[model samples]
Target: MGMEDRCLPGGKHKASPSPEGHLGTCHLYRENSCCSPDVIQDLTKANDIYWNRCGNLSSRCEDYLQQVECFYRCSPIAAQWPHPKRPTAVLAVPFCQNFCDEWYDACKEDLTCARNWLTDWHWGPEGNNCNRECISYGQMYKDGKELCETIWDDSFAVSTDPCECLTLSASDTGFSASRSRHEDSDSIEEPETPKKDSRRSGRKGLCPGSPLLHRLKKNLRKRSVFMEDVEGSGSGF
Candidate 1:
């Protein structure tokens, strides 16, 4: 399948991405999408135990969770790492360090009933039931690397590359086809550590791989707009 047409297995998604709007929280894909409006509605009120496996989740934690769900269900670029055994299913999706670290930190204290969320659930007619005791994310994994690597049964791995991976943000919408081709592999190499440095420097006026930089740029844009308005009013310095 072509890069613009890769959707998840089953009839859950459209064959190719198209325009969709009024999708509530999944509005990221309003311009182009695979998920139907109903699917996106279900996402906002989703009850897959992925977010509430423990109980009410912190907004920060759930924000990160919903990000992954949006990427998997709506983003056309996600299927680049198609599973070897299941052509329709995505696996080993490469995530950038900035995204994983922010996700892990937000949910670090949140509870979960499974280490491998893909396999630990006992699915029934209604939904999945947990077989293990719920535990905090801090207790479940050593750090962000372990959390991202283990949560989805190796469906995700962190890439050290600063601008070549997904941060699961709106800034990531520019994923390039030439940069995503991958050879099937069973194991992902360990993610390397980030060099201590400033968050200011990045290519393309933004770094899509780093959530910190993404937020920073967003604020900067807002500030620039505010200043422009101020200048138009001939305000004092």
Candidate 2:
């Protein structure tokens, strides 16, 4: 949307002091009784009577005027943005993602550059070097095994040591040599493989093949057990 189309009076510079005797085409003039001012003289009178004494606007009328002022102020931001406007029918609607695609497309390039910077600063997914959860993370179980296909592969193995790979805090337990020793030994002894067990009926041996599924399953089981205890306690009450 153009800046002119977004602002009140449809252009810059506010409406030209309302033509001679007319109240100019502001939406407020038609709906608000107090907005009957057409000239500087009338504005002075309004300022003396309704403004200083009776309040600038009645509670009923203030909302409409405030909304207009807010929209006028915010329209510049909306115009500066390249995202497509929501359709007029849905403009007043809330909590809708209808314009997300347009907004995402407009901001995608900047977001990608930011993510890259985070990667360099050791805050990105690539910087974590977490082969399990990082690489094997999937949107859902139904997203398929392909989501975890890149995990635990030779390509994911970095030539540099963990601490050298990223500037992590020496105090962080996970970044310590002892943590590395524990992880390496555990991975070697357990082989970090899937349990090959079934959780759903008629889905025999159809669990996630990714080792990250172990942590995911453990978390889910813990949550389930926690909820069960809560329910049991509530029942006793």
Candidate 3:
């Protein structure tokens, strides 16, 4: 198949905007507008040369340089295309991270190129932003897991798997945990103090079920009172 034909499976073309108004389709344009005829020919010739040279290598060691060179030659092709939309990145990064992790785990023992490729993508300055975003997302997920564990322990009479609690509505819980602290910070306001003694006492069990909830509430209330007292005393000076 020609380079344009091989660019997509079954010669399928991705749609692009054009001056004529209706959707336009071209394999080379879909790959990248920068993929001029000369560039396409050069890349194809390079691919052929590399494969002919390395296709029959007896060992991976002999193929390593050729593989690296081929990747180096091809990597620039990605830059020729426009960056993916932010929404697309947001949707795709998690799946990509999981795929990388799974592939690395299964192949790292024997595939030097695969290991190097992952490491380079994660650590190289040009490519690390996506990986960094994935890392931040992973940390938020860990935080959400911890939050679920805390809630599970506080609400249940007997021990249960925190992960099982997570499975009830994992995505919603994870998203809430990720955004909760920022939302709380932005929405902070002074708490209203209760006037009645019984109402004040009832506040000791902020959460339902666990006996420890009262103690947790009491400690938090004590800290709030101390801060209030300090603010009042400072205002007198």
Clashes of each: 0, 0, 0
State TM-scores per candidate: 0.70, 0.16, 0.17
lDDT of each: 0.65, 0.24, 0.25
Worst 10 residues of 1 by lDDT: 183-192
Predicted model with the maximum lDDT: 1
TM-score, cand. 3 vs. native: 0.17
Q: How many clashing residue pairs are found in candidate 1?
A: 0
* Cα lDDT over the full model 1: 0.65
Q: Tell me, by TM-score, which candidate is best.
A: 1
**Candidate order (lDDT):** 1, 3, 2
- What local lDDT does model 3 show for residue 232? 80
RMSD of every candidate to native, in Å, equals 12.7, 28.6, 24.0
What order do you get sorting by TM-score, best first? 1, 3, 2
Model 1 ranges with Cα > 4 A deviation? 44-50, 175-237
What is the RMSD, in Å, between candidate 1 and the native fold over all Cα?
12.7
